[model samples]
Target: MKQIGVALWLLFLPFVLFTAQAQESKPLSVDVLWQIERIGSPQISPSGEYIVAPVTRYDMDTDKGESQLWLFSPDGKTQRPLTAEGLRASQPTFSPDGQALAFISKRHKDDVGQVYILPMNQPGEATRLTSVPTGAYGIKWVGEHIYFISKVWPGKNWDDIAEQVKHEANSHVSAHQWNALPYAQFDHWLDENREAHVFRIPATGGEVQAVTQPLNIQLPRSSQSASSYDIDPSERYIALVSDSLNDGVSPNNDIFLAEIGATEATNMTPQNRGNDYNPMFSPDGQVLAFQRQLITGFYADTSNLVVYDLNKKTEKVLTEDWDRSVRGLVWTANSRGLFGTIDDAATSRVYAINARNGKVKALTGETNFSGLSISNNGILVGTNDSFLHPAQLVKIDTRNGSTTRLDTFNDALLADVELGTYESVTYKGYNGDDIQMWVHYPPGFDKSKKYPLFLLIHGGPHGAISNGFHYRWNAQTFASWGYVTAWHNFHGSSGFGQEFTDSINPDWVTAPYADTIAAANWFAEKDWIDADRMVAGGGSYGGYLSTILLGKEHPFNALLIHAPVYNMYSQMSADFAVHAERFGHYWEKPEIYRDISPHYYADKFNTPALIIHGQKDLRVPVGQSFELFRTLQSRGVDSRLIYYPDENHWILKPNNSVYWYQQVRNWVEQYATPGAQ
Candidate 1:
């Protein structure tokens, strides 16, 4: 009798824990989204024994985020923070010997971001390395030197720059003048006089030396980061990105090679009119690998992998005819191949490209993989996540593509949170091509009942909503609102073939517009979806498309357009002039702008809309949103506009994001209440 009672108690324990877990697993909310930890890409040591990554946490009440560098063993044991509270470090790069880690941080409250070094094997705190007043970014550790990029005033030293920055700050100069095309980037104003160039410092602590300043070529003004340059293992030759054209309206980034101390740099591929970037040297330092794009204005052009033979002084387009774009470019131990993440049919996969024949083979499938770090032994480590799962540290086997989770971050937090279910489906879209779409259902969804639909249109105009966990503008959070949320990788979305991506280039309407409406009609046919109560919304280009939907006859009851490019003529005031080079200026090609510009079709905007924009949004100016709101008002259409004074491109502040979501919910509820009937 006693043995039987003990067995029954043990059996009952499992059920009790399962019920407790179920009770804790509540629906995902904005609060939960903010509470979850964000893990960045892991940086594997040269020896492949350790991995370091930045982990960010947000405080809802404080409405602030804090990032700290954390170290983890490859086997998923012994996780610890390398830096303590109040200190934020980013872009961690391990030295060749794997003895020290170099990162960028602003240790002093008033100090600009500078390079700092922390000993990997020692128990000391991080020591500041560079004191550049303009701040150092895109840090890299190679051989015996630490390389970084900084935008500095010409003919000025460190002290002079510091004084200049202080003077500029103290001087209430409210005017900004630009003589050239690119006066601003995505969020910040670019100083036309200040040049962004690569500089180097000895790893053992020495004076900073300018590498590209004397070359008389400035890095691309609007876009330049760590990927723009790479130092060879020999530290003899440096490969950097620059453009011959100073027009600035067109980005003509090309790879330029220069000796370590030479004053001259030669353009490697001046023949290619498009963009070339992400310079990486082979392990043996004989071959240089970079990504090449074909189109200049179309940012979504397929990136082909190109390898430049140093001895031969010739270039080969490896992925010439391939349909997908290469991301996170990395070299193998033998320099025989490259590894990176690629988007394919609404999924991000890890692929290995054979350097010899350009044969592409996917290593991992389904889940979105990012922050790829490869070592000499062919060990690849990155952060992988799915729609239902948050990012986790992972190790990828370059040979078989098997993945091993290296860290169990947010597992407990997620285990206690009930998440909705999602799946990838197909539908015939524009051009009769098979289009992929992802549908997210509520946590306690029931197919027997009818639920309101929240159609989510992705931006990038070319980027896909892949199988990944997203904190901002999350589909799951929207699904938690008791609606069937979906993301359609319509025409012009990448990951499909090149033809499918470039199909909507100049038109920017016809195909994607048709596909979006088709997706709506497809979901309307489903018995479980309440077609009449559907709401559609998006950000950036997504907002642009939703604006297009407003002019067309759509089933959506309400629309949410955030940071939309409404007027083509007004968009020229943005960071990059849209369609000026591709379709010619509006004056030159009036029909192209007249036909597609949303403002031109304002007479048909009858649907209610909620408009949102940020003052710092340079990609799609906030003025665009103002123009849209005014048009809706002039037409007497029901509309509301929300403006952010401090935020940029996206709602980044925790409080601001929460408020944005709340207001959006209110707007959706006012127009089309969510829930299943």
Candidate 2:
């Protein structure tokens, strides 16, 4: 009898241990979350034989994102890490010679980025170039000098004007001064002194020279800000985009050609109604190529690539009829044509256009190609399935267009996990408009069993869901965990055309919500989706929509809102100043803002919600999340708020991102279970 009793106790011990372990898994940490690896900003060597890109990997154990510079040959035969410091190195550009490379590293303790040069043959410590307080960006090689864009303090006169405006805006102070101050006033203060100027420093070593002064051309208060300037191949003129006259109200950006070493600048495209940017000169410096957008009211027309002949003084559109934006341009060695990517919706394809005749031919048939470069031997292109796929460097034969995949950033890790396949689905939306969405089925999915569904909304009512793979908390990992995720490019989303993108203006919130609901209904009608256990979530604009959807319906068992806008009056009044121009002033359109606000109808919220917002999120302040949490708490609704300190609008820290996803997974499992909350 004693022996039998001991055996029974031993059997019960295992069960007890299992139960304890399962219970301990509560309050999920970052390790259990999904991991994503990505490669960004691929740059081909000047010789076009090698490609360099910033490869980022997240380690679950340490919860940190490690970025390194990686080099790959054109044939994809040889690929290796260029730097092993475990520091963040990005924007790699080959020196004029293929033997050396220049990159930006933030390894210094000063918290400022400095230029570093490393020899390809003898890999050792990189040579530091600049030690300025503010970091450098958009570094390019011009002869033996390196040209970059840096931000410095504006002149005293500008600072005084900025200070006066701040003083006047705050003439009336209340007890809730910090909360009541309009967010636009703060934005105006931040931009008053910031300007992009061209600076040059020696490649080897020397003091940096400021080539473009802020006073050279005053920007208009209503125009968009200026960015880095590009140097012509001859290094005689610097090309830059600025709205010095518009005062930040319009999107009309004029390209300026300033002679090297001279402060005088000439407006290349002097259109006051349209916007132009990303100016680049042909190899021979005879033709200038740039992108222009026509803005009408709240909508912007599709941007097109235009070429201006310096000698002939003629400007012509290279892709006039193409209903897409030409993003990146690289001139061929002969300078007769150029290779660029035509970005349409979320799909991008490589195209070669004749500079003289405005004729275009697709180089990459159906695959997404970006970060393209051309050389005498062949063309190097970065290819990916969707935004989530770590792009692989590929060499396409300019002669025959035969493609060969070269080096991949995180191919080894990606091999361990299978990726879901995306299929384009079209459904009839409100007013019979064709609504397009991309559905991603889980990897190794068993068609025999139904899977849970997640409806992911993209932010930017103007933002469209694309075919590209996303690295941050992407749908692939959810699919890996046995869930089918669908991303709908609802109305007001960009890339389809101007009319579709502009539909959200004035209406602001209802049109997008209707589109999302239509997508949900479509998924419900599908056989694979388990309508009983559906989850809905999104970040930023998507987050706002998710919260609103919760108040509108209780179909979703679980809801996740990341950096959502809950109160429109408070948000529009306290949000970024750019919102005033982007969405219009709430004072002028009070009814429109109030009727579309999610907070006004918070009492209708019924679904359990998990709110996530960055503590330092400037774009969508954490207060928005707090307000919703308070409302839900008062109403006895199930809601929880997770704050990530040191994170911004987008979570960049690896461990934090992983932890965020784990929390999401746990929340979904809790509510989306069989007969749960």
Candidate 3:
């Protein structure tokens, strides 16, 4: 009996050890993802001694996330939260003296977000700085005054606006009327009657004074943020972004320059038909720099950096010859060069552009860098992340492009999470041109084993898949489910130069569709990929492409379409129509719409698919997904439709997102089957 018991114990010991090892090397899941803290862009002080960023944490039970300001030392040694937990805080701006910090938050009796100021060098509670009924955002602490942007009813004072808001909330009428082109943006409806303007208040707390409201010029109706306007160092002048046309239909964004107290502002870019915004004044206030795009309808047009000499009142295009778009521009201390995050060849890199001659130099290579903030002493701090890691605050050495991690918010959560490896591979796509793609291998991946393929298509048709950590459609998360994932940057994807981006202009079908097909063929030849168990899909334009696949021949065993644009003609009902301004409308170019619209080939629907859409998605209306789902059901094809009424373009709620991932896993596993065969 003792010998038999010893043998049984030995057999059970091996089973227990295997279970412990499996738990130790757990893959990323939706529950674990919610536990990771998300760090926003860092704001460096004028002296570069102090840096502050907003860190947000989510609660699964509450299905909400709260942000708090966090302070970090320049040497990357000290880090702590500046605000109490459970309260939301954002848009941290440092005072010119670097002794105080100001941010927007809603606390205590505040019904909306108000400006709160805190002492940096001393221990003290934050004090409310503004009581405006409309609330404030996009704050900047410049000179002796704090500037902020707020949307208010036109010609209404603080008292009247407060009363109006109360009455509206109590009113029974729920209908919204709009007599304009842009009635909605992404998820929410825009108040056409209200106008967004800049306002200023004394740092010590006093009466609010309207800056642009008195000038009778308002920021763009569709959107307005910190990038909408800029104040000069002397606080003598202001440059703002305003629309050249007020009718809303095909409005052109142009920069307007005005004196600090003047009631009239001059239109600076009236000759340019395309959009020109993000007016940034140089350190010396000698030049005002902004971005310009020549094409009227294409939102992904190349953004060229242009400078205006304040003294001479002349405009010069600094990046006219460059193909890449200039984003997140920051003027150097000396005003001789500017650093910007540019999307280049499937990567978001930091590039230095000479202010005088437009000579461009690459600063950082690999991964993704965003929310660039530079101090007067030339300390660059930004948020950096990659496929295997979440966003981390880093101090970048401007000269050498070296980076030192500043904050360790998500370090502990990610320490034990076994992440998959990814690589950028180039393959011959449409027209025999090389297309770049990111391929992710599952954790403990072996070349000797055959795995299923999860092909993810990116939207924007113009938005390339750069190296960044994405929570919504994470490649590693899918790869963890025992499948190899890949994102193909097909034709029309940006960051590959202007010609490649514009190749699919009027016809959004031919080139991209062919490129996707080629990508699958390239993967089918891979020794590790099991072509028989391949699945493909995407969101938005990616979904449109998936619908295109539904009507055509492909190697995919299943499709996952999210928020797709099914019918080109019905797409005009969306807040922003596709190809209406650049290309003629469907009535004018009926052949183009008929030939490319996915709904036109509904008879060919045969593939099993999981369709997901949100009701509030105005970009690609929820009806698009419903239309495709209905078509699939009518044809007796295996399909599943998951509707999210509260979600917008993306699944955001904690519980809803977890459910979405589970449904996706279940649907994919039923068809393709995960793990090595």
lDDT of 1 by residue, 13-88 (tens): 9999988878877877888888888999888888887799999999887788889999987777868989887887
Total clashing pairs for each candidate: 0, 26, 0
Estimate, for each residue in 568-651, the C-alpha lDDT of model 3 and write its tens digit: 988988888679788888899899899999999899999999999999998999999888999999999999999999999899
Write down the RMSD of all candidates, one decimal each: 2.6, 7.4, 2.6
**Candidate with the greatest TM-score versus the true structure:** 3
- Sort all candidates by TM-score, best to worst: 3, 1, 2
- lDDT against true structure, model 1: 0.89
How well does candidate 3 match the true structure in TM-score terms? 0.97
The most accurate candidate by lDDT is: 3
Model 1 RMSD, rounded to 1 decimal: 2.6
lDDT (10s digit) by residue, model 2, range 560-588? 99999888766743434424555577787
RMSD of 3: 2.6
